[model samples]
Structures are given as C-alpha cells and as structure tokens.
Target: MKMNIKSLYAICTAALLAGCTDLDVNIESQYTQYPINDIAVEAKNADVYFHLRDVFGRRYMEAMSLSSDEYTAVSYGGGWYDSGCYSHPSLHDFRTEDASIDWMPTVISGITKANTVIRDLGGEEAAPADIAPARAMRAFFTFIIMDCWGDVPILDYLPVTNDEVVRAPRAEVARWIESELLEIIPQLTDEVSDNTYGKPTKWMAEALLAKLYINWAVYTASSVEQYEAATAENEKLNDCIRICDDIIASGKFNLGSMPYAEKFGPDNGSQVEDFIYAMPYDTYTATGMQYGRARTWKNAGDVEKSYYGMKLSNSAGGYITMNPEFSRLFCLEGDIRNNSVIGDTVHVYDPNTYQPTSEIALDENGKPIVLTQTVSLEIPDDVQLGVGDNTKGYSQGYRSVKFFVIDDDYKNGRNQSNDLPIFRYADILLTKAEAIVRGGTATNGETAMSLFNQIREYAQAPLLATTPSLQDLLDERGREFFDENWRRNDMIRFGTFENEYGFHKKDFPTARFEKTCRIFPLHRDVLNTYPHWTQNPGY
Candidate 1:
C-alpha cells in the first residue's frame, strides 16, 4: 500500500497516548475500538511506515534541487527542470506550479505517529523492539522537514483541538528535530531486519542530524552566532562521522570494490555498501512498484509514450542527465569514476518506432545499428549549447547516466529489482567534507581537505596536493553528489542561493534567484485549513 501523505498525517494526529484515555467504558459504545494494547502490533504495519517512507522519498526525488541547476519553463512544477538542466541557472522559482510535492503534511504526519508510538509503547507492556522502531521512524520523518522545508509546526502528537495546529518557525523546527533524534538515539536496537536494511539505524540518525547542522547557514540565516552554530553543527557531523566509523570498524559492513553498476545492482541490495539506508523494491506482482517500472523511455521499461511519437517524458524528464559543466569537471581520460557513473556516449531516440518495446538503435559510421539486447537510456544525444553555439536539435540535451540501469534483466523494460540509493557512503563522506569546510573554519584547512581528497581518490579523479578553498569544497560537492538532491542546500551553505544558470538567467521574466526564495510557501489550501499558521518569510 502506497503510504500517501494524507495517511501519515492521519496516523500521526490520530495517535492516542497510553494514559490519555480510560478503558472501563462500555464495549458497545464503540464500533471499532482498538484498545491501546492492540496498538502494540501496529509497528509491524510496515505498510504504513513504508508509505510514509515513499512520501518522503518522493519529496527528495522531486523537490531537493532548488539551488543547483538552471530554470527551464516546462509545465508541471517548472522550477526543477528550468533550474536543474544547466550548470547553474540564475533563478529557481519556488512558487511555480512545478514545485516539489507539498512535503510538509506528509512528514508531520509521520513524525506525529512515531512520537505517539514512542510515548505509548514505553511501559513494561511494550513489545521487545517496537519502541526502538517507532523512535527511529520518528527521527527519520522529522529530519526530512528539518532538512527541506524550514520552520514547521513541530507537533509532538496529533492536536486534540484545531487551535493547536499552528506552525513553528524554522529554527524551532530544527531544534525539535534535534531533540527527537537525541531522545530516541539510545532507545533503538542495534540489530535490524534484512527487509529493513534501509530502515533507520542509530548511525543513520546521527548522519541525518549532522546533515541538518551542515546546512546551518540556510537554516539559521547566519545572522546570530554563525560561528558557534557552525561549530555545533560540525560537532554533530563529527559525531555522525564517528558513528559511521564505528559501524565500519565493526564487522557489520564494508566498502565493496565492485564496479558502480554492480554496487547498485539489485542482487547486491543486501551488500554492505548498500547496507546503508535504501528503499528495496521487490518483484511481487501486486507488491507496490517492484521492478523499476519507470514511466518514460528514459527510464528503462514499459512506460508510456508521447502523442507526437516523441518519448512521453515525466516532469520535463526528471530523467537524470549530466550537466555539461559537471561533465567538463570530470577528467575524460582514464577516470574510472567517469566509466562507473557515466555511460554510453550517446542516447538517440527513434521517433518512427518509439513503441514501449521498440528497441533503441545507435548510429555507427553514419549507419543505424541495433544491438541484440534491450538498451537502457544512458547519455542522450541532446546537447543544448549557449546562445551563440548552434541551438538546433539541442532542446533536450546532455543527460545523466548515474541512475540509469543497464543490467541485462531489463530487456523489455523495467526490472523488479534495483534499490534506489537515497543515502550512501559516498554521501556520508561528502557531507563530512562539506561540514568541515563550512564549520567555521579556514578555506584551506587539513580537516576539510582530507575528507574531500578521500572522495577524489575514490573516484580516481585527480586530487589537489594543496588544501582546497571553501568554494572548491562546495564545487566538489556539486560534482560528487549531483542530482542526488544535495545541491540546493550545499549552494545555500556556500552563499549562492540566488545565482542564475542555463537559459533562466536571461529567460525568466518575473523570477530572480534570491535568498528570499529559500523555503516553499505554505500551500494555499493548507493555509486555508489552518489559518493561524504563518508562511515562511518571502514565500
């Protein structure tokens, strides 16, 4: 069951605390009365938790890149493709129709439910591991709000009356997220189920908390005690570093030297590198999105097509493509990272036979060549250049091959495996590097440089002998974690929230990429539901 945002909200708000009600009432009065004791098994309803997870996942996939790329003016939620397609677009308008899914309510709902579970399942009556899971789940959801939409009304549980639903500011929300994670960190169990590999571990909490602190500038506006805040946040990052180090030190997980494709392949879902948090998609027929059934040809599967015989694209092809600038950043010769993440030089689509199952062909020596097997969309043929350089046939140019699946099983389209890498070890290392850079330190400090160089070495990309500048760390982050949703926050931390990119710099008529556009507006309908809640500044 897909856990919709509304369901999370309903579950969180509906949480009935252990002592809040009396049990001696008449049985006939209630048609479906789940005694508080009955709620103990509710944690097993991973279905509900999974839905909430999906809700958070959707927000990350869609809304996480407000500060990184260019701004193209496509239809639904125009900001992403417009701002995202290029190296750096001047404006990433948040108020447009194409903004990320309204993630506020869904996250709030999850946090509420998790807290309620923690509150109610604590007595001697609670199950062996229920409380830990509840706390972990709560921490997971709260981190999303703290990281994405700043300043939310942090409700510990569902409000008894409508008046209690008023929202809180970003700082207060961050504190609340921190408090919840700290409260539950010690309570969670070390051992987790195999199916729950991506589920929150104790280390995951620390990492997420560290991430929240890493973006302290955007969260706190760097107006007060910026150094202290950065320091404090970095401390949390260090704590996270320690946590990952400890996990690594133990025999539980290890870095796999497997090729990048094999590392992310479905068979390795249970592998140690993948042992970090990831969403597992199974092959069960009715089992909720098993096998990457992408909705477009860009995604390797039997999704739909465009009416004009062009490949039907989703959301202006949130299709992950490499930015030309990012591509240039990489060393073309002998960089294994290039081969691991980047792929087939070109991805050309045939309009005449653009059927769901029609095999994509390539042009070799000016002759169309067809491969024996089904092909995944890797680097696309589209290459949109600057104003002066030829602009013909380059509208949909320069695609990313990082998330494109090329394993053999996806011949006809879509596979039942391939867990999406939400948070990975590479991210952990990158975050540590960024935190060290932004944590009230010098531009060329050893602490930050060491972390940054490790990533460079891992990628087999050249590393700098001298320490890196602060901007260097941020730029490196862009290259290391592109399209993974860390760009907006990293840009904001580096003080580039308002820069322009792609065609948006000269194209957008009304919007300018300003710092004021950081947080999303409280959805208009949500404001109608709760009038007392104040919208974020400048939204």
Candidate 2:
C-alpha cells in the first residue's frame, strides 16, 4: 500500500507509545505485543516504508552531495552549512565525531524496522507480498550502511548483547545484498500501480542488483591483496551487464522526454522512462524534500512567494553551490540541465502583473549586481577552501535548482510533493554503457555509443563522433546527474573522487588525497555501544 507521510507518522507514533512505560506492561510482553504482533505486520511494513523515506530524504542527499565534487559548501549559506557538517566534508577531512555521524543512527533505525517486518512475516501466517518488499528494503538499507561506513553490524533483529553488534565483513554484506535482491526480484510486483508507486518493485530490484555488481570490486577490496583478487575476475562487470540487459529487455522503462525541470515537478508522477524507484513526497501529508530553499538565493524569495506563495529565505548559511569546474560539464548553449543554475540574468517580475520586467537589481554603489556563474574544471589557485574562506557571494557560484520549485511545493514552504527519483532508466543505460566499456559486450543492437548519443540527443547537446573514454563517461555523468545524489559513487567508481578539484581546501596536514577517507569512520556512539566494534582506517 502507498502509505502517505501523515498516516505513517501516526502509525509509528502509536507503535512507540505501545512500547513505552505508560503501558505498564513487562518489556518482553511489550516487544511481543507491539513489534512482533501478527496483526501489526502491515503497519510494520508501513513503518519500514517511512524509514526508507527518511533514509533517502533531503538530509541524506545533502550529506552525500557535499562529500563529492558536485558541491562546495557556501561560506555563509543557510541550509546544511549552518550545522557545521560541511566543513570537514568539503575539505575531505571527515572526523570520527563529525556531525554527519548522526546519519548512522538514522540508517540503523531503518534497518531495524525492516528487520522487524521480515521477522514477523517469517511465521506460518506470513504473506509473500509483504515478505518480498520487506526483504528488499532490508537489503537496500544494508547496502547504504556498508557503502558509507564500510564494515557494519548486520543485525538480523535488534541486538540484545554487545557481541551481537560486532561488525560484519564488508564482502559478506555485499554478497548478502546480492543474494537478497536476486531472491526477491521474482516475488516483487512487475506492474507499476498506485499500490507500488513509491515501494520496491521488480525493476528496482534489478537496477539495485546491477548497481551492486558494478561496485563489487570496490566493496570487496580493502587491502592490496583483496583489490588484486577482486579485479582479476571480470565476472562482476559481466554480471552488471547481464542485469542491465534484462532490465532493458523487460521494456518496463525508457528515457523520459520531459523537460529536465518538469521531470522533477509535483505532477511528474506519470513520467515513466526515467524512474526505476522514487521516494514519494506530499506537501500536506508526506513531506521531506527541501532542495528549493536549500539551493535558491534569498533575493529570489520574493519571486517564490509571489509565484508559489511559499516564503523561503535566501540560502545565506551556505547553499550547496557547485564547484566552479563541475558546472562547466554542461553545454550551456543547449543542455537542458543548465536551467537549474541561475546565471547572469535572473527573471525580475512586476509586482502587479507578476510577469518578467526588463530590469535588474543594483547594488548600493549603483553597479548592477552580477551573478557570475562558472564551474571551474581546473584546480583552484588558493588552497584554503573551507567555510568563510575563498567563498563566493550568494549568487557568485552556480546554484542548483534541479529539483524545480513547483507552485504547490513553494506554497507549502519546505515541504514538497515531488517524488525523489532514487534510480531511473537513464542510469541503467549509463550503467550498461560503462559495463560494456569495462570489457563486457553490448547486447540486442545496443552499443555504448548509441546509449550515450541518445542521452546527448535528448538534451539537444552535441553527440559524440567517436567512442567515449572512461573519463568522458565520468564527465557525462557529472553533467547528467548533477545534484541528483549520485556523483560521489560515480566519482569513486571512476577513481577521481580523491583527486584535487576546484576550490578544495587543504585541511589535511598529510597528502591532500587520503585513500582511507573514501569510507567514513564508524560513529563513536556505535563503537561505545559495542566494545568489539572496530573503526575504519584513518579515522
């Protein structure tokens, strides 16, 4: 069932209350009565869905984006920078006690909730439909945990003892994810209906499996020994190609033809080709998407209030603006994705007519305010690139509005109804192309060049005359998926994440690029809870 945010909230609140001291019940009885109750399996499933929403929400998006080259923390922007988490992330200086460490508990909560559903459904009275999605979500949560923190405790259910919380091998966790996704794909619903709109489906499983196999070598390798062994076999890339081919042959999705802005609009529910999985949001009932306020300037607030009737202050606390170099990837002449970046001439509207006026803002000195938008693909000259240093003014850098501010979404302030696309067919096509470029062969008349050309054609940008190199594909992904929360993974896979890029501050005393910083340190709280838990290297 498609559980809206409000309903899920109420369900989760009631579940928490049932296990509280006010109930006057024993701890064991409360656990049995609330979490594992046979009648509450559906409600538990709904809870799991809500947890997944939390997992992929705006906070997680901002965190991942800041860690990559796609964005640089604004020295004085308002959104995530105000929390002080952007400093370390922007400089590639993650600390064991950094504020981003909070994400671990949120991820663990989602995993625990999904595990509850699976345990409850394991009974004789279990429903296959419920078991399928629950298991898939569990794997999804597990994948995220391992992806971020490297080795993590793979909890079957909640841990009652410290030993139960010990970290599992990263390789084992990857294999578990692969096995779970493969086992659940056939059981997941094949059709896209309201019942499965924001939920896991067969296609999502296939896409996720493809993702795992493509990143197999990265996930399984920590030391030189493991790294050499992992790459010696092309089986992982071959498996990725096999899954991508299956998804393509299924004919369930295609590349979306809508304008880039409209693809993320409130009414984008019907657009099919691009979405493999999305987290549904509703301003009134289910809401957690907040990119409009985070990326737009405060000067544009009047426009937002006038057009959409929502009041959002300027992102003066550190808008997640793109590194000057990353912005250059777009063919500003024709690439539709460039629409998200506000440039030299912003549309000024007449108060009465609410139509564009032939006027621009002027500074106190009578000079016209220039919103210079540039993505510096070259390394920055100065190296002190942290908050409040080497920072640009509000409109200096190219700010992203990829998740467009629709009228209804603005009317509701930070809340939005646009479903966030987690995986889409466009990504699948790119995955297939990358797999083929890495040695796997194309299937069914689909060549890597053809897929690349299709995306370029849709954007009205120049097409390639020759096959693309791995670096070319990496740049293409930067332009196509900018601010879509995939840059970090893509950069890591391309082996460019640790390379010095635009506006990167040298905060680390040692070399600028530290290999251990790729995977974040385990949260201190988790280590304190489990004495046997070990931290990731270079913490």
Runs in model 1 lying further than 4 Å from the true structure:
1-45, 56-59, 70-91, 96-99, 119-129, 192-195, 222-251, 266-268, 272-275, 283-322, 340-395, 406-416, 438-447
Which digits, one per residue and each the tens of the lDDT, describe model 1 over residues 1-539?
A: 22232243235335632322211223243233334453534533343355454543344455654345512212122322443332122234455233354556666666655544444455335554566566666656665665565656666553543344655666776667677777766765555445346566666665566666665445654422232322344335455455445544444443456654455443446554534566654333212321122112232222333221233222122233333444554553444545323223333332222112233323312332221111111222112222211111122334343343332323322333445655666666566665555443422333666766776776667777776776787677666655456676666666655554443353445445555565555666556666677765666
Scored by lDDT, model 2 comes in at 0.65
User: Could you tell me how far off, in angstroms, the CA of residue 478 lies in candidate 2 after the best superposition?
Assistant: 1.2
lDDT of 2 by residue, 1-539 (tens): 23343455455546643212110113244344334463465556666666656446566776688788887665432334444565567666676666655577777777766665565556335666667887888788888888888887676554442334567888888988898888889888888655556667898899899989888877887531244321444468878988998888888787766666667766566355578888777676666777666665534553334222233443223356677677777654677666555556554433222233466644333344456665332223322232333223555666665665655455555666667888888888888888888888778788889888878888777888887788888888888877678888877767777777545545434224676777777767767755577778777
TM-score of 2: 0.84
Model 2 off-target regions past 4 Å? Answer: 1-27, 30-42, 77-83, 123-127, 161-163, 224-234, 302-318, 348-369, 374-392, 406-408, 411-413, 505-511
Each candidate's clash count: 28, 17
Q: Deviation in angstroms for 67 in model 2?
A: 1.2
lDDT to native, each model: 0.46, 0.65
